[model samples]
Target: MSEVQFACSTEETHQVGKPQAPSFTGPFTTEGGLTAITLSSPSEMDQWIGEWIELAQQTEFCNAFYEPTFFQAAVKNLASQEDWQVVLIKEDAEDKLIGFFPFVRGRGPARLSELSLWKSKLSFLTSPLIRSGSEQQVFKLLLKHLRTMQPRVDLVELPMTLAEGRVHQELHRLIRDNLLTTYHYDHYSRAILTEGHDYDELLTENIGRHHFREYRRQLRRMNNLGQVEFRTNEDPEYGECWADWFLELELKSWKGEGGSALKQDPQQEEFFRELVTSRTRAGGVEMLGMFLDGEPVAMLCTLVSQKGCFEYKIAFDQEYKKYSPGMLVQLHKMQRFLESKRSPWVDSCAVPNHPMINRLWSERRSIEHMVVSLGRPWANIVLGAMPLLRSLKRTFRKPKR
Candidate 1:
């Protein structure tokens, strides 16, 4: 575990990562005087850290994954290749950064060369970093550049992004205006906790009386096991310790036997540690744990951006499964979200129709996968057929009933 050298502060400063001089020279500048620079390494982002941090602060749509602190850890530890491209869009008039997009030319559906948005295993959001007031201009310039690239990017796919966010709305607007060609698929809703709902009333309304009684019964059983307590770690000095505990606790569960825990992969462990250490002082990351007699039985890792929270990951010791320690911790977390002065809403970041979260959080957030034609008619034709292809695939892939 790495010790974070910082003090807790309500406000975060852009003084992250060591400074490095701009290594790439002669970036491609669009005719509209917007400079688009693509770097092959996340470390190259050091030169524009200030602008990138500022853009994250003023982004039109909030994506905790796109934030510099999270991006650095994800790219450095999780990226599979050096070919990943970090595209930064800057306006020439005022020399201000308007957008940040990470891309990679990879094999997409049909094994076609696709300029796909780069996202790691745990990143659930793909909304690009676009300056708040400059979304329109940024999108226009970005799409135009993508359309006219030298090698000719015929396909660009955003694997995961908010379905109804401002960025998605702009994509729709551009498509309706005949400025772009695109295809959307895999649209689904995930569980979310929304504001203004009393947690007790929500439970009374959503959970069946008998089911709620059983849950309470399980909680009472756990209380009988030992001194049960729910606690959260926000102190910078203990962030690394909390992260370590989370990893160990997760490994004591089925995830470990299945080789799916963070400790199962060294790189994944490193990423989690660095992310916690980096964001500890800024208060962008937190760990909530359910402890029995001072031993953790369940844990949750969360990412905070602006006022909203993303429940990024959760794990529980299987030894405590009978008492449902995982769900119990979530119950406490849900209560905290509702009663805390912070934002009332939280994105579970769980898979669609997740058994546990869907039952607990009645609200939903729409997300989708989108592909752009990038001004290629042939690609547009293929893109148009994707939904049908997907439908057929699903029909054939379903298990025989």
Candidate 2:
């Protein structure tokens, strides 16, 4: 609401029903004169997305959710009253953008405030946007400033972020000097692309030629079932055919029975619609479908980001599981993707040890759930007890037979 606060922004009232832009009044400072701007609204950071992407190009970690289109869509679709900050960190010298950390400030135990990256369940990667080499300095600036926030903030949680990425390493490096006690919870597994090999060759080498041969056999059998075909929607002009088919296909799966399908979740459906419709014409969304006699059997959707195309959500008709329709369609598209070399990689966006993706991709992207104590006594207790609680649960679940 203040028109002249913060350091890296110029606040202007847009009255779009969300918190107004935070002003960059050059007040929030850290070591080396680094300053920050936190805007409660996503629109306020629209102007900086180009710079954000430019910086991301030089880093090993990138989550497509940081893209302006995707970020705005998620916040608009998913309402998290307490969780959303379009943070920009920069140097006071030339006032250049050095870091972009879009997060949801969290409410933790004992009323301590928290800075967290993974906001919605839809967010697969929780990495911050910062150049590769400047990671340490940027983290220092952030932690130092966070130390001084009013009402006393504590606890920094980065859920579903890469454990092997630069951000995690930098956080550990800073813990030695800062008043931060950190803990890593190995929560999820992710699959990554392997380079320098053809998709077919990789499949043969990893899944084995016998399995590949069986897949081919299944494809032939499916052809006999009908006019089998694999289709992709990428042209900006293409309408919502892909989404309609995908929803229908997904509804027939277990997710639909469990009431987790897109149509069942209003927020998810809204987010998916905007993400696909807004980017379809720009080649920013890719939809792949597998069909038998024009009947949808499987479908995969992805959001194209600066780093690469990321698998958003996928589904298959369980009735056609005998033909492995989902795997077949994904394989066909992957072969083309390999040949196209679109963005140098494809993130499976699948959970680690995922029975499907891990076996197919043969590469791992390390991810972890983490927490940092912001020097608060309550935060320290929460962080200290979390692991113990998990351990107790694990022990209680052990079979005694």
Give candidate 1's error at residue 167 in angstroms: 1.2
**Model 2 Cα lDDT, one tens digit per residue, 1-401:** 12234443433434467443334433265567766666666666666666655665666656677766677788788756754565678765644577887767768645668777745668777677787778888987777666765545688777777677677788788987765676677666578784467777899988999999999999999989889887788566664666677877888987998989987887888787777777787677888888788888988887775567788888999898888888888788778778877676778887667897787787776777877897777778788887788899998996979
TM-scores, all models, native as reference: 0.88, 0.86
Candidate 1, run of 10 with poorest lDDT:
1-10
Quality of model 2 by C-alpha lDDT: 0.74
Candidate 1 structure quality by residue, lDDT tens digits, 1-401: 11112222212332456343233443354647776665666777877788788788786557889888898889888987656666778876666678898888776666656888888987998888888766677777777666545455678888898887677787777777765567876789999897788877898788877777888899899989989888888578898899899999999999998999999999999999999888887889878999999999999889987657899989999988888888988888888888874864689999987999898888898999888776566676787788889889988996989
Model 1 alpha-carbon miss at residue 366, Å: 0.7
lDDT of each: 0.79, 0.74
Clashing residue pairs in candidate 1 (N, C-alpha, C atoms within 3 angstroms): none
RMSD of 1: 7.4
Q: Judged by lDDT against the true structure, how good is candidate 1?
A: 0.79
Model 1 / residue 292 / CA error / Å: 1.0
Candidate 2 regions exceeding 4 Å error are: 1-27, 30-33, 47-50, 53-58, 92-94, 109-111, 396-401
